[model samples]
Target: MSALNTSVLRPAGFILMGFPGIEHLQHWLSIPFTVLYITALVGNSTIILVVKFEQHLHTPMYVFLSMLAFVDIGLCTAVLPKILEILWLNSKDISFEGCFIQMFFIYMFVTLESSILVMMAYDRYVAICNPLRYTTILSKTLVCKAFVAFFIRDLVLTGLIPTLASRLPYCSSVCISHCYCDHMAVAKLACTNIIMNNYYGLFVALSILGVDAIFVGFSYIMIFRAVLKLGSKGARLKALNTCGSHLFVIMYFYIISLFNYLVYRFGKDVPVHVHVVFGVLYLLIPPVLNPMVYAVRTKEIRHAFLRHFLPRKIDSDLSHR
Candidate 1:
């Protein structure tokens, strides 16, 4: 550790430049963002509540779905509040500790979500391909282990990012060019050598999300193969239908995330706002969309919603009429 690194360990703070060129637009942008945050909160919370109260949803698939919803809520809560503050109140100053803390939860939940997707893919694979053995394979004990393993893996692996970044001496400008405290965005502000940080970040991204994505892809391929082999067309369609929601979630999460990652890594010539906008989208869209996707695509979730809330809605409507 250099003397400069030690001196700047506790620098003043960082100023988050929400939107540089269109500062006025940030307030306008808050409208949609606020809508998204509320939608994500309400949508995911509904899923969690439904899964908890609905006895029929106690299967492995819905257990994993509930876990995904919980992670979505954590992910949105980690970034959206600070972003709203920056957009609405113009309060962008974040202490060094605060920035790293936010970065920690953001990475933690993102990786956890990735792991959950992989688990969901596996759940679908077993249910569709080896239906007779799905219960035995994805038993309650195994599901508990899966959750513990992924949570620990994410905490241990993704935790390195913030831990390493926090140690770096940020002797340069403290103005971050984005709304939230992204690891790379904060790393770019450091004056010292960040080659280790950059490389480690890439390694973590590939090892966690990359490996999980590969497994998910392989699982789906096997699933499709099995589905195609079924003698009855109705059987094939039914099997594939169960997987629709999980597949859409995988595509939605990875597309925005990969786009943002590629842009951050290689799209240097791209405009700054473009990077910031996509980064925000990557964080925002999946949480907002995940529960809705499941609610629309999965029959049981819809029925659970109706079973729990539809009667109340009907009664209220009749009273008003």
Candidate 2:
């Protein structure tokens, strides 16, 4: 039936195979996926709300954190709900235009999140290496300008991906093997030669992840040097401690991302479901863990979270008692 329908230059829609080999287990999969989605939603929302309300947390670091949380929420919302619908409702069809829209938001938020992490690393570097001038260097104007610049960069670079992919005539099977509208997965569905799309997509991924990773690593190296030069062991410990959450989040983001990228592109002998599961995880895990890591590790965020969620009397009692 699908082969007969392939005569059309562009199909009406595409079927998102939630997990290609384990279709029978989609119901079971949705259980954990729902939990993750809800966790990400609540966790990132709490970060944004806490940072917005806590006047003392309005520094460049926390401001960047809130930006990250916002990106996380956007990234999750872009595809997770569609995934849930596919898994639970068995509604796997996505219109041609809708798929590109999902691709756009996913890439946009992912890029923004990467750039924000770089900014956050720079924020940490300024705070630790040049404390006296931290405020002056990372001024509101500077931060705003940096964010705007990267945001525009994300828009230009990521927008081209979907735009170019869309131009390709998807006359082949309109079944996407993965959960959501992954750029490469969708590009593979096109009947035309997709080498350009493949190369450009790989280029974009490397540019965002590779360059950002290098800058972040360099920033930390400089930070470590500055920390070692501090007068006391306690000061050095405290300085490194401040970066613990950010470092964890960065490692978590990059390691999983790099592994998933390699497995998807190179691990041809790997199972399709494994690729799909990792792809889902690639988007899901960060949003779920980022706020939890920060909440557990950052004192200011923890306190503000308690003050907001716990009742006044209970918060006071917990703090005192």
Candidate 3:
């Protein structure tokens, strides 16, 4: 199988659905992403390093943060280089196998990430709502259990689902308009009658994405109930304060996910670039932004940043002075 590009929509179709903005970007868009990526790299790498070095951050929340940063690193590494390479060289020529591999890891990391967030919510809920029982609730045993659950679920979603999906035989154009191996992209290229394929695709999507959404929602529901009962408004605010980064990450992921599904189903005539642009943002932003948001929001991370980076910056400033 090989990748090829053909317009999925004719002019009449274009008029109805309009263009999806995946491939469309101003020259300036790359500049911000460049800065954001460097920020992401530094931000996430620092989180990893701090967690590894600091005895104080050995708690469950920081452990989850560490895993989340690692996942972010994996996610960015998977997508960013290809994106930068393609943008600079104008080469989006991903091979059939290479595309599938990309999809597998991206899928794996995304699922893993969702699970990590769930673990973090549980960690925070225990910390805020059950201060005395927090250690018992989120013990070392329990954290390891959570990690096992994360990877097990991750494997099922990314590996099992894609394995079955790939076996169906790709009989269409191999050129995945977007960067990675999306199920819909491969499904569209399948040579076989794809009714069964589509069914499986939707089924798997609903299972992984659907189930994770439910868990995160449930965790927050419990958290909110606990928050509402706090006598002090300040206490309630403090409880929610930890959720800020997580909420941002979840909102970012789900909105893009819903947009992608909606565009694919309803906006068939949208331009390839439109789809490319949004998908690229969706894939890259959370991984990069998550560390920055979390670090900025929390004292521990802020202190870590200052302890780690500020001294270097200060030294440079003094050198110039």
* Clashes (N, CA, C under 3 Å) per candidate: 0, 0, 19
Report the candidate with higher TM-score, 1 versus 3.
1
lDDT of each: 0.87, 0.87, 0.69
lDDT for predicted candidate 3 compared with the true structure: 0.69
- Residue 80's lDDT within candidate 2 is 92
Q: Give Cα distance to truth, residue 302, candidate 2, Å.
A: 1.8
What does candidate 1 score in Cα RMSD to the true structure? 3.2
Greater TM-score among 1 and 2 belongs to: 2
C-alpha positional error of residue 203 in candidate 2 after TM-score superposition, expressed in Å: 1.0
Error in Å for residue 299 of model 2: 1.4
lDDT tens per residue, model 3, 57-162? 8889898998989898887777777666655555566654566677788778877877887787777777767889988888899889778977887787568656
Sort by TM-score, best first.
2, 1, 3
Alpha-carbon deviation at 253 in model 1, angstroms: 1.1
Which consecutive 10 residues in model 1 have the weakest lDDT in total?
1-10
Candidate 1: C-alpha lDDT: 0.87
Cα misplacement distance, residue 301 of candidate 1 (Å): 1.5
| TM-score between model 1 and native | 0.92
